[model samples]
Target: MKQNLDLAPVGNCSVSALIDRCGRYVWACAPRVDGDPVFSALMDGDDPEHGFWEVCLADLKDVEQAYIKNTPVLRTVLTDTNGSAVEIIDFAPRHHKHHRTYRPVAFGRIIRPISGAPRICVRLRPSADWGARRAEATSGSNHIRYHCTDLTLRLTTDCPVSHILEERTFRLETPLAFFLGPDEGYDQEVGPGVAATLDRTVVYWKDWVRTLYIPLDFQDAVIRAAITLKLCAYEETGAIVAAMTTSVPEFPESGRNWDYRFCWIRDAYYTVRALNRLGAVDILENYLVYLRNLVDNSAGGHIQPVYGVGLEADLSERIVDSVEGYRGMKPVRVGNQAHEHLQHDVYGQIVLPLVQSFYDQRLIRPGSVEDFCALEAVGDRAYALHDQPDAGLWEFRTIARVHTYSSVMCWAACDRLAKAADALGLADRAEVWSQRADTIRARVEAEAYIPEEGRFGASFGGRELDASLLQLVDLGFLDPMDPRQVATFNAIERDLKKGPYLFRYVEPDDFGEPETAFNFCTFWFIEALHLNGRTAEAREIFEQMLSRRTHAGLLSEDIALGTDELWGNYPQTYSLVGIINCAVLLSRSWTDVR
Candidate 1:
């Protein structure tokens, strides 16, 4: 319960909450992932008295936590010094109900005694206006309704309301259930409905996990990562968020925090590819809808780097001065400004996922002519802007460059479009796109490669190395074994590499040098190493990275190279994608064992 950082996440796709080891609901957004945090204690400084919902044992001694096997449901066992214990089952209700996903803006918990009688107290505090105001509470016999300015939450419980309101310690006689959601009264008994939802939710998650094409090795790690990725998705609109929390610093006092609760095209592309490899087409199909929506709404113009989970275009960035950031890292940010930048790589990210629909017959909605035509407009942007400068994938605030990675992705966009066109039997369109891809590839090789240094540069002509260059092999711009790629890998390892982790880049930016290592970049380096015939080394490094995950088998966006501490947002989609991808590449095939 005393653990400060390295928090674990639990959520249904619609909403999520970060629960600390002390069995406290520290952070949760309402209605949607990007909504105002109803429980904002994670960013409310070190105060444990407000902005949180917690069930505290009067004489707590030991605490142990884990997920209900193969599920997102979390189980925490708290043992009191008096030799009494209670199990806390926490989850967001998610299962099939009435022919659709029953995920709601809700949080549920059941506390059952596992040993002798245990004394417990409940602290339920929800906030609004980014922690500027606490919810006004009103209670009846079995429920408490907390009303905020724009939102209300009803806490239906099986325990006495007096015990909760007065914070009185009571002996555990029967299992108590609490359900928090949109301030709507329950039609049935709270205990039975929550119990049944727990049963079904467990089945739902296990059944989904069974469908995964997980590798023989690291199956648990891969499955855990996969579950986090699924939780990060906004299922209603098929938009996948980059992470659950926002503005957890990338490094101590480095001022490198950003809101990651929105969907980044590049991050979604990598996330879906990982899920696709696991044979999870539902996520891919849903994300394609988000992408298609973007293309349709683009009005035949450029696509932004990021967007709201519900496809809102203008995400104006601002800071919340009310709530102190995670670990008192001030300037808690809400909205993202990356929505206005022209990150050319998005054009390719959009096309890459759409390309899969054309060939993968597993998808519910395969590629059609309308989809192709819409995507053609996206490809047109990639071609026209391939040589131009924009905010790179890193989204540097002050600088723009024709980054090698962005250019390579543009080439990938045209290249995949040509292939998709040919598959669709549009020969003329295929020819034109093929010629365009050739032109882009030629330009990238001529300008992105540093001939004097015998390797590819981060920008068109600069000599700086970037971890994103690890993507050149992935995008098919260069062979993994090509001499230039080999040299580039060597240079990256020599410069950006810190132990087993890799920094995105070391150059000074508006915020000074990025002091932390990007977790996903290290995975990219492992893949590159494996592709270049360092298969054993790749497996070793891959294992080391796996060891870096939190106790919940999840990772944040960035890690401190100096202290090996997780510093960024929780359950980062990119970090999980790295886990899935590296496991797929390095794990030995089942055929080998057979």
Candidate 2:
């Protein structure tokens, strides 16, 4: 089978996994989101026998998969040639318990025979050391323990241990429940406990969805996007991952893959903003705590573009050669090297999200003057480096230029800090920041704008076009109808747009020119089209983008322009944020209900 992104994700914000169409647990990390990939089949392209957990139906004929309603719970039904079928319901247990939310680093699977008697084989193979070796197994009467170098996982199931250990085929007689968790004994009956956990998990998701203020139109799409974005968040530390799995190339053999399992300030800001639009303030509140820690730790110094979920700073990149990459591509990388690059927009991304805490009265602990004072230090760096060259938001590995988008973000930092100062009755600080914003705006207009081309260049005195320029209006840097902004948008569309998708840029970077269209940029184009009064065209393009989503109504970082194939990491938070943002932008007004 060709490697594809036709997968669904299940998690409780603590740990997550990717399940393929055939109900195999293809990828999951142990201990935490950034931990070892105990189930590493997603990255093991050459040898698929190990590093995965699957239930194989004898003589399999057809397979069907879908998420249960509003939850991340996935249900896959496999039908055999003889009409025997079985339903595999998979979810990670998450609900309220004791005095707090009970989300464990565990997976729950309930196997139910829904039709004729089905004979199935259980294949539970997990690897350690990045697929260098299969996990050693020890079995008991009802459970089996898989031991890896750094982690040990226990599979507590009601099924016969012999059938699982021997990978023996057996006739389905009754439902079976499996709980894969820490190396501990099961306190409750496996079947009953898992069933109860499933019930509560469903209720928990449904109740959470009820709290969202979604748009009237595309409610289903919006909810799914919202839930997927929520799943990307690591609640333990309030850091949101960019995507689930790593080393999934942007395009086949393109070598454009980068590990996105850690938290990027830019990506998390977008995720938190999208959820905040849905009135989901809890995520924002928790993320604020994470941000505060980052700010406090930095003490107004340099901040990396990305960090580990636990706020670890040194993310030195290394290649894991044991496992073949997606589709046998080499060099499955672990840590991201972007941490060392000077992505100046991070200064603004940090401050932009903090602006909400000062203005929003709903937060339990609203921003105080102390918070504003600390953020001013970030604003100082933004002002000082607004014109300096660094790796832009795209993180071009081999080049450095004073990108307009980065400068615009720096301007936003100062501008928002001015507003926050005004809100706090600090007139002196407000004037200081306002002056800094004006100075950056003047420099950007003078250097980034091309008078002959009647548009803003991607960088100072450069003529290249970038999709990030389309955010001129979104970031409050330019008016939607400004003639310069319009010309820039049209120039970008003429050069970078292919069919219904948009490329981040056409220029070749560290890798050769990007072969796939960026999903987030396409959405930005959709929003721009809408803002420019091309609502009809914008809606048409938005529908086209939506049609390109996977079966689970999710998108990756990049799409093959010619084939409309998702080609990047799985369930990208950036793409999910696009769905929510565009839905809210294009949906009909709620008053239309009358």
Top lDDT hit = 2
Candidate 1, overall lDDT? 0.89
Off-target runs (Cα >4 Å) in candidate 1 are 1-3
Candidate 2, superposed: residue stretches over 4 Å from native: none
Q: Which RMSD values do the candidates have, in order?
A: 1.1, 0.9
Model 2, residue 73: distance off in Å is 0.4
TM-score of 2: 0.99
Native-to-model Cα distance after best TM-score fit, residue 463 in candidate 2, in Å: 1.0
Error of 1 at 586 (Å): 0.6
After TM-score superposition, the amount by which residue 250's alpha carbon in candidate 1 deviates from its true location, in angstroms, is 0.6
Each model's C-alpha lDDT? 0.89, 0.93
